[model samples]
Target: MKKFWKWTNLTESNPTERILTLNGTIAEESWFDDDITPQLFKSELNSCSGNITVWINSPGGDCVAAAQIYNMLMDYKGNVTVKIDGIAASAASVIAMAGNNVMMSPVSMLMIHNPATVAMGDHNEMQKAIEMLEEVKESIINAYEIKTGMSRAKLARLMEEETWMNAKKAVELGFADSIIEPDKKINEDEKEKNKASDSILFSRRAVSVALQNKLKSHYLANAGANTGTDITDLEKRLNLLKP
Candidate 1:
């Protein structure tokens, strides 16, 4: 099982500064149905104090669990900085709202949409479900409104459309405090990777940006996974389906 939360500060010598990673799903592994309850999360969090840095990459999970984590970070005595290195969508976006300073990587994404669940029942049950979903959505708006100060009506519209935002858009929308700046110093190896990476974009990233709206959003294979739906694969599949 992958550990969703871990203390990243290898040397635990300083209580005043801490680093933690909140990667993968917000709470646990969905494919395996693994669980990380709020109670257990608190047990780990209670030990840390002062400024904390959290690295997030999640497709999101149980809203209740995310709510607990969000509240925990919001109420923490010291500063909390959140860095979105990949994707933060659904409940993970809720958690992102808790950050005192939320920074998104250059190409990272922050997605916001209506909450959903599986319900099995009849007319009365369906009405009850709708009512419940409406209330849950209102609660979610509270987080977004606090962070962005956007009007409820506008926020509702964005949620209804399942908005997908890149780092720039995220900051412009007030969902992110700022875009992360590239490190000033990079070794030769790192510089080589950066220099070569963009030269080969056509082989991987061409048109992926424009197609983000087409797919809404695809779940991260796992928290740390950076792979996206390849355009070639998508085109091939569409060709097959049309015939």
Candidate 2:
């Protein structure tokens, strides 16, 4: 699901220190199919007109979208800090690196991977795709090298491996400045509650019956798991059957 960009401040009365949060896949179009524009981000920064903090939690998406966002952030004059609340993968990682100071949540993730593309038809099409991908790779590599002060070659290798770095690892690599530890007790309490809910739901007789049939027939036959249509149908049936 695509989350909306949420804006907030540390304090209510003194709201000069603005925060813009980017959560979910950083695609050309959001999961809801809404178009993303550099103008929208620029407008947000302009509205803040103070020290800005960008909170990132994304799986990354279009290179063009990433590039536009990167350029906008780099151009902004005020201090820009990035707090990684969850995962910043691919282009989202590029945006995170633009921050003047990058902070990561203790349990958050940062990922980088080589650029990929799909092409059809002849040799020319394949060659064009390769060239385009190389350019995209260079752009992404430049962002990491500039932020982390790491060697381009080294960054390239890490990206090639599709590295998934935890908060501590990100700080060690200079991709993040510090790890922000949240209230662990609160998180643990939430987890315990969620576990109880899951246990109760999964123990239901109807759920067990559905799972058995799914595992034996539908899931076994379709090993690859084509989900959308069948899942929607099942959900509709279950909803209709509910008293």
Candidate 2 lDDT by residue in tens digits, 40-118: 6567667757788898988988767777778888888889989999889888999898899999887788888888877
**Candidate 1 Cα RMSD (Å):** 11.4
lDDT of 1 by residue, 1-243 (tens): 455788764445865777878887765643223354555667677775668888889988877767878898898888999999999988999999999999988779888878887787999998888898899899999999999999999888788767788877788778998878787766888756644123211111224434643553443334256476665576666556431
Global lDDT scores for all candidate models: 0.76, 0.75
Model 1 gets an lDDT of: 0.76
Instruction: Provide the TM-score for each candidate, comma-separated.
Output: 0.71, 0.69
Residue pairs with clashing backbones, model 2: none
Q: Least accurate stretch of 10 residues (summed lDDT) in model 2?
A: 195-204
lDDT of 1 at 193: 60
